[model samples]
Target: MAATVFAAQGASVAAVSTTVPAVKEHLGLSATATTVLIVAVALSAGAGSFAGSAAIRRSGPVAAMRGAVLTSAIALLLIGWAPEQATVTAGYLLFGLALGGIDVSANTRATAVEHHYGRSIFASFYAAWSAGGVTAALLTAGTARLGWPPAATLTAQAALVLLLALTLRAHPLPAAPPDPATATGTPPIDLGRGLWIRLAPFGVVLLVAYVVDSTVSAWSTVYLHQTLAAALSAAPLAYAAYQVGTVTGRSCADHLVRRAGPAAVIRIATLLTAAALAGMAAAPGWPYAVLAAGCVGLGVSALAPLCLASAGRLRPGAAEAVLARLNVFNYLGVITGGAASGILGSAGHFRLAYAVPSALVLVLLLTARSFAPAQGVGGGVARTSPDW
Candidate 1:
């Protein structure tokens, strides 16, 4: 439900951002002013992310998620009613703060759930998120057909969020008692450990996979419309295809992991991801783009869950902490991928942005032989391969 709210509001905001030129005309503002407004929104989102990390560390996930929902709803209300530039900017900042808080808190919750379940479920959870995004994208497109004003559309989204929040309260998982062996809180197993060494290649593979996913989600619509000369109405279909593929891929990931093991799965997925990116870069039309996007989604789908599951298997007692540390790198991928995409697009080489991550995946494939096999629960670290 929280994901749905975020997806709906995010899609609405994206639509508004895309129609900035028309909005400027309607509001009697220059193109420069509109560009500044959008930049302000992006900056506020960054600040919110920084602030939210601290908030999650201090307040716990349930409080943080609730705060994010309430704050976002209020911000949307302000955006709907405020006429002054200063007020609008402040609302955008608040909206960013809410998004940041939600992002951190939700992931933290997911990590906790995975630890408690004692199995791989992260990819399926993310698939649920993609389902939310798909719903939001469709709703936003429908609203566009109705000729709804941006503010009104956003306000309606806020109402829906509030309703969802009321219907579904935040439920954080209970923290388990710490085991003394791993309870020292000293960062579990240093980077030099054999297990860490063996896991490094798999980690690198997941990192590059995340970067590829982020790049596609952030830029595929624009790439479809601007670079491929697709109709604006059809651009979002690329994302829809990707989301569908992710959902489908995740549904079978656990079985695949059980049947083939993480090592074999990662190797095949990495190669497929490289091929998918190459296809996207060379796509000649919308149909090809959609097919390529689906391939990309399927190829990248199991990477994250496999990494998290591997981390859990590596140090069952310290799985949460290990996963958390790896998440820091995952976030770095998101940041760098977005910046790289922007730079490449500005230089008229947007395709390189996708291709570069493909190369990174290939590098991960070369290093794949080094990953340790999936050790069943209760198995000691001694039995794990030293290649990680």
Candidate 2:
């Protein structure tokens, strides 16, 4: 149920995210201005992580989800109908706040549900998010093709979430306490304050994944429209392609993880993505560009979740704190990477912008080993060859 609501929220925002190119034209925004807008959204979203977590703790997940969804609806309406630059910018921030809350609350609930079931079902939750994103991208394409006003389109998307919310159960699910058993059989490595050092690789990997993700989500449409001369209706297919890969990759990630340890799977996947991104940057036309987008989606699918899984169990009782800090890393990557790509695109270097993150995939390749099972909180587990 929670995952379903999260999916609706994901779809609503994805519509805005993938259609930025169209939005820019709608408001006559400069590339620099669009960059600023995206950066603001990413920054505020990071803050929402902490704020949303607090909300969940106090009011419960259902309340937090409801509040966040409605908040996003209001923000979306403002964005769709705002008369000027400042109004739309304000709307982006408000949307960011709501997105942050939704992200945390949904993930927290998913984890709890997974724990209750005593198995690994968390991947399905993320697959749903990607599915929503894909749906939104497709919807945006269809809506644009039909010559719908961006304002009406966005308002309808917002309404979808609000209406979906009405059907949800009134109360939140029971909070599943954090699993006491260590995630990795290995004993915990208490770095004390130095735990940051141990967590650096996880952070680095997540940063790169998000950087690439932001680049794609925020710029794919722009690239297709401006660089390839794609029709506005077809441009969002680039983002849709990316999300399709994301859904398929995540849905099947556990199989790969189980077949080949995470290290091998992630490293190989990064390599494929890096190559795919390079291909995307040099795409000759929209069809090729969309194909490249799919490659990228599959390539980056497992990175953020794998890293976060490792980050969460780094410490015995500090899981929340550690996870919170990692969330900050996630947004930081988006802000830095998304801003850089947006600015570069603004400057007529969209190809270079796409190419850069492709290069960063190597950095993730180097850090792939970081996804190894975490140190035990008390005693180390048996160090099996494939355990990592």
The per-model lDDT (C-alpha) reads: 0.60, 0.76
Q: What is the C-alpha lDDT profile of model 2 across 237-278, one tens digit per residue? A: 989999899899989876676567678878987998899999
In angstroms, give how far residue 294 of model 1 lies from its true place. 2.0
For candidate 1, which ten residues in a row score worst on lDDT? 379-388
> How does each model score on TM-score?
0.72, 0.88
- Candidate 1, residues 337-357, lDDT tens digits: the string is 656775676567778888888
- Candidate of highest lDDT: 2
Model 2 Cα displacement at 128 (Å)? Answer: 0.3
- Pairs with steric clashes in candidate 2: 185-381, 186-376, 186-381, 187-375, 187-376, 187-380, 188-376, 188-377
